[model samples]
Target: MNQPHHRPDPYTERPWLNPAISPFIQIQGVTKRFGDFTAVNAVDLAIYQGELFALLGGSGCGKTTLLRMLAGFETPTEGRIIIDGLDMTEVPPYERPVNMMFQSYALFPHMNVFNNIAYGLRRDGIKSDELKRRVNDIIDMVELNPLTHRRPHQLSGGQRQRVALARALVKQPKVLLLDEPLAALDKRLREQTQFELMNIQDQLGITFVVVTHDQEEAMTLATRIAVMGAGQFEQVGTPADIYENPQTRFIAGFIGSANLLSGTVQDCQPEKGTDDAPDTSRVQIVTDEGNQLLSVSTDRVVAAGDAVTLAIRPEKISVTLQDSAVSDTADKVPDNAPNTVSNNGSGTVPGYVSGNVPENVLWGTVQEMAYLGRLSTFRIKTDAGPTLEVTAPNQRRVLDNRHLIDWDDRVRLTFSSDSAVLLTR
Candidate 1:
C-alpha cells in the first residue's frame, strides 16, 4: 500500500494547523436557513490573507448563500464569522469592512463611470479631493480613465465589469468578495480578465473570495478551491490536489470525469504472492475475470469481503491499439503474474483486445469520435458496462485514426492500478 503523503512542506506551514493565527477570514460551523429549507448546512472554512479562494458548485448548492453570509448580506443561523481577528456575528453590511461585487454589475444608470465608482466614498462622507484621488487611482488601475464620462449603457459588458471590480476594490476592505465576476463577459474577454484579476490581487495583497460555477475558471483563478455539494463543502484543496487525488466517489465524479469500477475485496498482500501469508490485515480488490487483486494503499481500515469502488480519471489512463505487452512500471501495481485474464486480451476475445496484454485491460468498441481543437474525444462502448470517454492529443496535421479503428471496431483500454483509486464509503 502506498502511504498517503500528508507531510507538510518544510518552508511553509499548513493552514488548518494554526486556525487561530492563520486565517484572515474564518467561518466556523456556519449554517444558514430560510423557512423550512436549509440553504447552507454546517460548514467550517478559513481563507488566508492575500490568497484567492473559490467556492465552486452548481446552482442551489448553497455556494451563493455561503458567500452572502461572508459578505454580511445574510446572517448565519449558527456559528461565528471572524474576519481579520474581529467577530462579525452582529456586524451589519455597511459597517463591516467587506465589499461584494454582485453578479449583475449593479451600477446605477443615472451615474457616470466616475460617480459610480466614487459612490461608496461619497456615501462615507469622504472629502471631494481625497475621493477624486482615490477614484482616479482606481480608474487608472482598471484602465477606465478614457471611459470616465461614459454611462453604464454606453460601455461594453466587459468594460462595465471592470467598473464593478474597481468599485469593489476601492474600499480597501480586508476581504473582497466577488459573485461570478467574469460570468457576464464573452469567452475571450473572460479569459483575459482572469489574468487581470490575478495581477490586481497580487499587487494589492488582499484576500479574495470568489464564487464561480465554471470548473475551468475555478482551476485557473483559485489558489485553493472549496467544492460544495448539498449545501456543504465536499473537499477543500488546491485545484491540482483535488483533481489528482479525490478522496470520495462524489468528489472524483464532480471535480472531473472519472471511471468508477466496482469490485469485491479479496485477501491482502504486501507484494503479490503474500496473500495467504499470516500478515493479512489489509484489504485487496478482486475483479470478476479471475483472481485479479489490487492492494488498497489508504490508511483507512478495511476487512476482507468488503465492497469497494475504484475511481480513475480518464486522463490518467493511456489507450493503445497495437499492444503486445508492456511492463507495469508504476510501483502501485502488484508484482505478480496475471492470475486473471484480461477482458481485452488477444485470444480471450478475438479482435476485441490486443495480444498477451495485462489483466487491467478492458474491451470496448469505438462508437463515436469528436475532434476538438487540441484533443480528439472518443465515446467507446465497453463490454464491462458504461460508455467510456477517452481523449487523444492532436500533435500534427494528420487525419483521424478512424481507418485503423472505425465505428464498431473493437479496441482495448489499458490502465495501471496506480491510476485507479479505491473509493470507500
Candidate 2:
C-alpha cells in the first residue's frame, strides 16, 4: 500500500514520493565491468511499484548498462537484483518477468505491425486466437489499429515507436525497461509522445524504468529521477527535488542553469518566533567577489567561516535599467550586509519606478540579449569582471515599441536572499 501525503503532483496524485512506501525494486551493490572498463560501479537504488522512474545521465554514464542489468541482458559482476520478492540475478532474458524496449525499435522490416506485436506470443507457442486477441488489444490501447496492416518500412518514426511500445505491452510484464525510447522521433512527436507513454503506464500500472539523456523529457515524464555520473548515482529524488535542491556542484550544473558563486558562511541567524512556526534559520555567505549573500536552509548545521556555494537560477534574478545618477560601479556600492527583496506595499520590487538604490542590486551593463518569445535572456557583465545571466519575462505587451532593459543598457540586477540556494559541497 502507498503512503499518504498531501503534496499532490500533476503526473500522479498518489504520494509515491513518500519515503515510507516499501520498495518494489532494489539494486544493491551492483557492479559491472567489460575488459578492465568499469561500466557500472557499486550502486544502490530503490524503486516503488507502479512508479515511473528515470535513469537520467549522459552517454556512457552507465544508465543503459544498469537498465540492461535489470533486463537480464548484462550479468552483474557482483550484487543482487530483487524484484517483487524474487531474485532475478540468474534470470535469462526471455525468462525474466520484465520487458525491454530497445532504443532502435528493432522491428522486423518484413513483418506488419500486428505480426510484430504478436511475434513474442507466437514464439511462446500461443494459439492464433489468443495471439490475435492480444495483438488487437494492444493495438487499440496504443491507438495503432489503423496501421496494423502496415509494415515497419511503411510506418513513420512515431508509429514505429508506438508499435514497439505495443509489442512490449502485449506481454503485460511486471516491469518495462525503455532505453532512450523516444530518441527516434522528432522534437514535436517526442513531446507529444511523452504524455502518451505516461498515460499508458498509468493505465497499465506497471513499473517503468526509462533511460534517457534528455533532461526535459526526464523532468516531464518521470515520477522520480536518478541522476547518474561516472557509473554511480550522484543524486536520486523527484524532479523538483533534483532541480531545486541539488546536493552537489555537478548536480547544480547538470540539471539546469545555476549561477554558482563561491562563498563562506559568515553567520547563522535563527528566527526568533513562536514554537509553531518552523525554526527557520538564515545563513549569510560572503562571496569571492567580497559581496555577501543570504540564504535560508532548514536542515543543515552550518557555522561561521565555513566555505559554501550560493546557487541560484537565472530566472529568479530581476534586472531593471538604472540611470547613471543612481547607478555606480558594482564594487563602489556600500555593503553593510546582504539585503533581501522587500514588498513596498505595492507587492513589487523596491526602486522599480523611482531610481533608488535598492537592496541586492548590482551594477552591470548588458552584453548580450537573446530574444526568445515570451522570455528574454540577457548576459550582463558587472564592473567586478563577472558575468551574471538573467532571464526576464514579457508579461505586459508594449504597443509603443518600448523595450524593457534593452541592449547596452546599464542595469541593476536584483535577486532576493531567499532565491539563493546554499550548497556546502
Candidate 3:
C-alpha cells in the first residue's frame, strides 16, 4: 500500500514564509546607544508566533543588548517594540507579557524547588490553592517532581536549571527569553538539555527568544537564526539557509567553516526564465589562485571584471588521490597556470591531460588530517598558494592505523559549481 506524502503546513510550521500572517513580535527601527558607543544600530525584525528564534553572535556584538530591549530592560534609543499588537517600547520589564531566565539560573538559595517555582505566583497575590496547583503542574512539566523538596544548594546544575525554568514558566508569560540557558551545563548535559528545552517550548507553544554566542547551539536550537555583527544583524534566516547561502564574507566565515577565495568576475550568463521569476546568473570567477570557479548567484548582481569572493564549505569538497598515470604531467603544470574553459564549458588546467580531470579541480598535498569519529578533515596545501580544507565521511571502521588517505600524500580536490557560493560583499 502506498501512503500519501504529508507536506508541511506553512501557516503553522513556518508562519514567516506566509505573507498573509502578521508577526507576533516586531522590532521597528530599534537602536540602543550607551555613552559614546552604539550598542545596537537601527535594526528591524519580525518574529511570528511559536517561533524559537535565536540571536547569535560573539561577545560585544549587541545580541544581549537587543534582547534586553525586547525584555524592556533597556529602552530603545530610536524605535519601537510591538508584541502581540501592543507597543512595549516603554513598558516595564515586570509588566511586559514576558519572562526571562538568566544565564546563572538565579535560583533562590533559601528556597526549595517547589517554593522557587511558586514564588512568582505568590508575589502576584494568587490564592494559595491556585499557586500550589500551578507550581506542581509546572514541576511535573519540567520533570522536577522528585526534586521538589530540594533546595538550590542540594540540587545538581541541571536540576537547578529546571527549577529556574519552572519558576519562569509558572507565570505563563506570552514569551520566554533565555540568556544562554545551557551555558552552565557540562557538554554532554548541555546537549541533552537542548532537546528538553525544545520539548518544553513545543508543549507550551510559547515564543522563545534565545541569546547565545555559540554558533552550534543556535544552529541546533533555533527555528531561525539572526547572526549579529558589530551591533547589527549580518544575516537572518533558517539554519540551513544561513549555512548554505551566506550573504557576505563575514556571515560565510561566522556561521560555519568556510574556505574563502578572492576573485574577479570573468563572465556572467543569465538563466532564461519567465519575467515574473527571480533572476539567476551563472558567474565565472578567476580566483587569486589562478583557478577558475563557477557559481550560481540569485540575490546579487554581478558583471564582468567585478571583484567577488567564492565561499565553499569544507564538507562540500571531495578529496581523492591524483591519478598515478598523470602524476608527472600534473607536476609539469605551473602553479599559476590559467584554467581555460573547454568546449563543454568546463574548466581545464593548462598543460594537464584534458578530460582526465573535472572542472573546479585543484591539485594539492595533504598537509594535515584529523580523524573525527564519523568523518575526517584534511588540510590540503594546493600547488597554488592557498590551503583548502576538505572533510569526508569515514564509511567503515579501520582496525589498523593506516588511513585511506594519509598526510603528505598528493591529492586532488573537486567540488560542483552549485556547492560554491558567490559573495559580492
Q: For model 1, where is the 10-residue window of minimal lDDT?
A: 329-338
User: Which candidate number would show the highest TM-score if scored against the true structure?
Assistant: 3
- Which pairs, if any, clash in model 2? none
Q: Cα lDDT for residue 117, model 2? A: 95
Query: Clash number for every model?
Result: 0, 0, 0
What TM-score fits each model? 0.83, 0.86, 0.90
Expressed as tens digits, the lDDT of each residue in 1-425 for candidate 2 is 14336554533444455555667899999999998999999999988889899999999999999999999999999999998889998899888889889899999898999999998888788877888898999999989988989999998888899999998988899999999999988999999999999999999999999999999999999989999999999999889989988898889889988888887776787765455445656676656773534454534668889888888788988887766424543334333222323323233422222224333566678999887879889998865445788899987674566667778998767766556677888
Candidate 3: the clashing residue pairs are none
Candidate 1 scores a C-alpha RMSD against the true structure in Å of 6.5
Residue by residue across 1-425, what tens digits does model 3's lDDT show?
Answer: 13325755656778999999999999999999998899999999999999999999999999999999988899999999999999999999988999889889989999888888888888789977888888899988889888888889999998888988989889998999999999889999999999999999999999999999889999999999999999999999999989999999999999889999998887787876556556677677767664545454454688889989999999998887766424634444443453444547445424223244433667788999999989999999877557899999988785687888889988777776667899988
Candidate that would win on lDDT: 3
Off by over 4 Å in 2: 1-20, 272-280, 290-298, 323-359, 398-402
- What is the lDDT, from 0 to 100, of the residue 330 in candidate 3? 47
- At residue 184, candidate 1 shows an lDDT of 89
Q: What local lDDT does model 1 show for residue 119?
A: 90
